[model samples]
Target: MTSNAVSIKQIMTTEVLTVHPGDTMEQVHLVFRSSDIHHLPVVDEEGRVVGIISKSDYYSISNAFPLFRPDLRAAANDRLFKSLLVEDVMTRQVATLTPEDSISIAAGYFKENLFHAIPIVDKGGMLVGILTTFDLLNYFFNQEVFLPT
Candidate 1:
């Protein structure tokens, strides 16, 4: 079969780690480190994706306030870091692709948005899987077995 006939689900990683809106920054950091994934889909209680977070997002927060170090003790008057939350740093507007979506369509979205990964959802907008650039590349370049028609 041609590559176009192959659905994204065939190669996409179905195991996904998600963060809730109320999750703390420290928790998110731990998840990122353990999962070894830069992008995370932020979901609500209903399991619907509400936002996306990236390593860059955490970096941006760190960059904005150099004084807010984990080792540093906050003075009684200091409140800059304590008020920070995931909802404040995560990208509320997220781009998503459906599980049945063609790999070509996902490729185009990646090109247009310059995204490294995209959250895959089902028809009901529930999180299903995740598609990354590496997944597509591996599928396209890997040797496939072919039998006589």
Candidate 2:
């Protein structure tokens, strides 16, 4: 099927890893470091997508407060980093697509924007999945059967 024919549900990753608005920056840092994905959808208490956090954001803040090798200094730095909330740094205005959106729509987004990821939401505006340029590339290069027209 062409990209226009294939819905985002077919390619979007449903196993979304999300953070809450009140989550500590240090927790966001750990998630980014451990996960292979670069972008995180920030959700509210009700699990609705509220914002987005990129690896770049994490690095930008964490790097500015680098921990010293000394235990005392490292502890102090760690405390400072942990005190910041994800809401303080996450992008409040996020671009999102519904599960019904087609791959063609996602392609258009990637083409026109600098951001690499888009959160997928359900009809109720609840977080459902995430789509990234990597997903698009993987679909085009590895899954040739679904190549766009």
Q: What is the lDDT of residue 134 in candidate 1?
A: 88
lDDT of 1 by residue, 75-145 (tens): 31134334667798889888888877788898989899997788898887889989999899888777455
Task: Give me the runs in candidate 2 sitting further than 4 Å from their true place.
Answer: 65-77, 145-149
State the lDDT at 12 in candidate 1: 92
Clashing pairs in 1: none
Using lDDT as the measure, the top candidate is: 2
lDDT for each candidate structure: 0.79, 0.88
**Model 2 poorest ten-residue lDDT run:** 62-71
Cα error, residue 138 of model 1, in Å, equals 1.9
- Angstrom error at residue 22, model 1: 1.2
- TM-score top scorer: 2
